[model samples]
Target: MSEPIRVVVTGAAGQIAYSLLYIIANGEVFGKDQKLVLTLLDIPPMMGVLEGVVMELHDCAFPLLTEVIPTADPAVAFKDVSAAFLVGAMPRREGMERKDLLSANVKIFKVQGEALNNHAKKDVKVLVVGNPANTNALICSHFAPSIPKENFTAMTRLDQNRARAQIAQRLGTDISNVKNLIIWGNHSATQYPDAANGTANGKPVTDLVEASYLQSDFVTTVQKRGAAVIAARKMSSAMSAAKAAADHIRDWWHGTESGRFVSMGVVSDGSYGIPKDIVFSFPVEIKNKQWKIVQGLKLDSFARSKLDITTKELLEEKEEAMAVCNGN
Candidate 1:
């Protein structure tokens, strides 16, 4: 077997980590034969919990998992790492302002970003999964100036999956039949779940579903699915989020197959008039181990308006982070 690829995951003791570790250990994310050295990182206080999790990982006895190291130091965790999952962050408290939340996460991401630049492998691919993921990814990418901007991304696959599932249910079809769904712009509520390009067994989704419902109710449901899950389970989503993260990395490193595209929040290259440097989700086709924005799709007035709104929100987030850093 070839030497294992090293992967670093922050928030090692968090619920999402609990769901992610086992899958990664079994080579579900990388590939069945690919080996991995997993570094689990957390704050000092959570080290004991992380260690316990590491013990469970050992119990699984996955042959592809070469090693599991739990640490509190970013530099130690990221050392020679090939891929990074930035899952740790200060979530918004009950009454925290947006600026306060941004300030708190900036501190965490800044440290991790610097560690990535100083210690991680030359080809580190980073996925920011924590809340406010796009901006958080942008911060990390900015700090690691040497790393290609395209290597940094944030998760929107969850939203894409949610949209697919919702469309499947509404059309009374199996989820497997759904394809070409896209979640554009921010991963937040303003995200545009475009059914315009979606297909259910080779037919346009809009052709089979009510256009009004698709434009209004379906869009709302997809964007609000996270909150609905939290309300239904009485806890934040972990397993599904972890699965989505895994799917993201899997598709990214392996490649997306023909006739399918996934949504990922990558650093924009001024596509569709979105500002450069703002990380926004787009319909993307991944091949040759890289993502290319799907171009030449004509958006109707509704889709265009929704995309504009979400892209504007992402820009505002970038501005807010910049202002906080500037103490404005």
Candidate 2:
């Protein structure tokens, strides 16, 4: 067999990682033919808890999971890894502002970014799944200059999945039937779940759902789904978040079907008039393992306004992250 691919996951003891690691071991992320070595990292205080998580991983006896390394050091965790998931960050506590959350997580990502730059493979793909995800991604990418800028991204896939689910439910079709939908700008409540150019089973989405609903309930529901999940369960959304991250990486690595462009939070190149410095979500297609932003979609006035709100929020978050990262 070929050498096992090294994968590093931060917050391995956290709920989302707990939900994700088993599926990845089952060859859900990497193909069944490939072997994997999982390197798990968390805070030093969480080491004992991480030990039990490692024990659980061993108990599963997955054939593809040949080795498991648990550590409190980012350098140790990220060394030579092919992909690293920056999933561990401080959650937004009650009464904390978005700026406060972004500031708090900045240091964590900065340290991880430096470790990844020094120890991880230059081609490693990094995904930031923590709260204030898009701006946290921008901060990480800023610190990891050795890694390819395009390889660093944040999780907007969860927002996209929610949007597709709402679309499919309303149209009475499978979620797979919803194609080409876009989640524009940040991952927060200001995000716009756009179906203007999307399709339902090869037909224009407008033909299947009313525009009034698309711009009203569908947009609001998809944007606020994360908070809704939290309110209903009294905990953050874990399983669905894990599933979305899995799907995001799978499609990125294996490529999506023709005519489908999923939403990904990538560094902006001023596309759709978003600022170039912040991480922003855009509709993109993956080919040759490279994600290329979809171009030439015309956004009418309403779409423009909603996108503006989210991008502005991202820009503000970027400012706060920079302040914390630079020790201001």
Go through the candidates in order and give each one's C-alpha lDDT: 0.90, 0.89
* Candidate 2 residue-pair clash tally: 0
lDDT, candidate 1, 1-328, per-residue tens: 7789999999999999999988888889988888999999999999889889998999999999988989998889999998998889998878998778888888888888889999998788899999899999988887788788899999999999989988888878999899989988998999999989889988998899989998899999988988898899988889989999998999999999897999999999988878888999998999877899999877999998998899888888888887765662
Candidate 2: where is the Cα deviation over 4 Å?
none
Cα RMSDs, all models? 1.2, 1.1
Range of the 10 consecutive residues with the lowest summed lDDT in candidate 1: 319-328
TM-score, cand. 1: 0.98
**What would the TM-score be for candidate 2 when compared with the true structure?**
0.97
The 10-residue segment with the lowest total lDDT in model 2: 319-328
Pairs of residues at least 3 apart in sequence or in different chains that clash in candidate 2: none
Model 2 Cα shift for residue 136 (angstroms): 0.6
Model 1: residue 177 alpha-carbon error in angstroms: 1.3
TM-score of each: 0.98, 0.97
